[model samples]
Target: MAKVFIYPATSLILSDLVARFGHEPLGAALSIRERIQTPGLESPPLQITPEDPKKGLRYAAVEVPSGVRGRMAIYGPLLEQSEAAIIVTDAEMAFGCMGCARTNELILFSLRQRGIPLLELTYPKSEEEGVQFVKAIREFLAGLQEGGS
Candidate 1:
């Protein structure tokens, strides 16, 4: 089965579809819940590793660019572990993380750099679009089953 990373990670629809298709969904909520429930953790932006500062910082401490690194700390691992990715844009309308513009750029850039099999979609507005959205997702995931680039 493929490890499919879903952007926003908290969407009921996407997660359900991925699981229904027999893939693991790497969602943001999963990451957040793991971090929050980990023993001894109090808050977010926790250190990924001891701060080196020379390399980019991953903790929620520190201030731009680096803050991006901090926030990405929570997210980057999920990205790295994925065999494929499904990113939904215009998700803010659906109460998903629109995230920082720069972070969006970074995430998209990193995904492209990794050259994984990727499915990019716009969140649906109406019933017809929703059908097309699911169709696209189903096709992409089925392609993964068949073997992907």
Candidate 2:
């Protein structure tokens, strides 16, 4: 199964939809939740050693506007491991809000630079729009499954 990274990872609805379509959803919220809940690992999120915030500082060093480094630290790992990506551009705080604009730009830029299959969509407000959104995502994921771009 493809590891599809869904941006604004706090969106349970989108993440669940991705899983229903048979692909693992890679997102920061998923990792954070898993780390906090799992007993064998670190209990609180701040204690986790793998995704160090210091590394994010290194990532920011390459660019002039380095404001997003801290936030990127949390979200960048999933982006690196993803085979495909889906980003809801108009996502709200109800589903999930990316509080930082610079970080969002960096994530989008990184995804585009990767040149992998990417699906960019708007948040659906109505039932009809939601259906169409799902169809679009399904088609993109289906294409990936069939080895198409």
Candidate 3:
């Protein structure tokens, strides 16, 4: 079973990738509850403190620093012991939502430097678009599996 860190992206592409391909995908604090139902590792999801003061204390969206670190900490060892990593991101837009962009960049950079095969994808615009995205992702995975590394 290949391990894929979907990273935090718009929509639910990450989870979709995991569900469709049967790949192990790490989830953030918010997603942890949902992901627990899936048959996989029981590691805790990442949780980051929010940088926005407007959000007040105890404010942590899914894509905060803690979430990123949580994901990295939990998945880092798994990735180190595994064969590859797959990260999904919005190719069209630059991340600018507080610390989310930074976290994403770090995750992307780490995965790239680790020499894991990286596959970047743009966010889907519509239902049909989502189908296409999933198809493309699945095809990529199939190619990798068939090539036998």
Candidate 4:
């Protein structure tokens, strides 16, 4: 299987998806604080970063660009290297985000325009619900694989 990029809004959701899918996540925890809190969110051994830009890709980060500076900082590198991206949002729009909705929409639009596959995930109402959602995603990916084969 090729590398699949999974981006979840929270560390918990990202961990659950990676564990269930049997693919070790890449940068599931983006920072020192996250790494300390969630030690299990490291990239799998299979992951390789190709300098050529074709064979390797990075996982998308959660930082949304709110203004000119932020936009310049975040999107260029992400949209350039990622062949596919997964975006997750808290079901209730937590994080007390001020300008996130618009920013996310624009990012999604840009990603789509580049023909990159983007999966948008929403948090489930309960833990069980989250599991079910992950299962559904797994099944969906399975179907795509089978069809592609």
Q: Which sections of candidate 2 miss by over 4 Å?
A: 30-44, 48-51, 62-67, 146-149
Candidate 1 vs 3: which has more TM-score: 1
Specify the poorest-scoring 10-residue window by lDDT in model 1: 34-43
Model 1 residue pairs with clashes: 9-27, 9-28, 45-60
Ranking by TM-score: 2, 1, 3, 4
Clashing pairs in 2: none
- Can you give the TM-score per candidate against the true fold? 0.71, 0.76, 0.54, 0.47
Model 1, runs deviating above 4 Å = 30-63, 146-149
Q: What tens-digit string does per-residue lDDT give for candidate 2 at 1-149?
A: 78888877766777887888888888655322322345522122455454454668755664634436656666777777788889898865667655567777878888889888999999899999989999999988777862225
Model 4 misses residue 50 by how many Å? 29
114 in model 3: Cα distance from truth in Å? Answer: 1.8
Candidate 3 — which residues are off by over 4 angstroms?
9-13, 32-75, 78-82, 91-99, 146-148
Tens digit of per-residue lDDT, candidate 1, span 1-149: 78887875556568778889878887655232333354422233435553433234442235546546755666677777788888888874343553466666777777777778999998888989989999999998877862234
Task: Name the top TM-score candidate.
Answer: 2
Error of 1 at 59 (Å): 12
RMSD to the hidden true structure, all candidates: 5.7, 5.6, 9.6, 8.9
Question: Best lDDT goes to which candidate?
Answer: 2
Q: Tens digits of per-residue lDDT for model 4 on 32-125?
A: 1322233232222233333322321222234432242243234445555545555555644231121344544655565667665456767678
List per-prediction Cα lDDT, in the order shown.
Answer: 0.67, 0.71, 0.50, 0.44
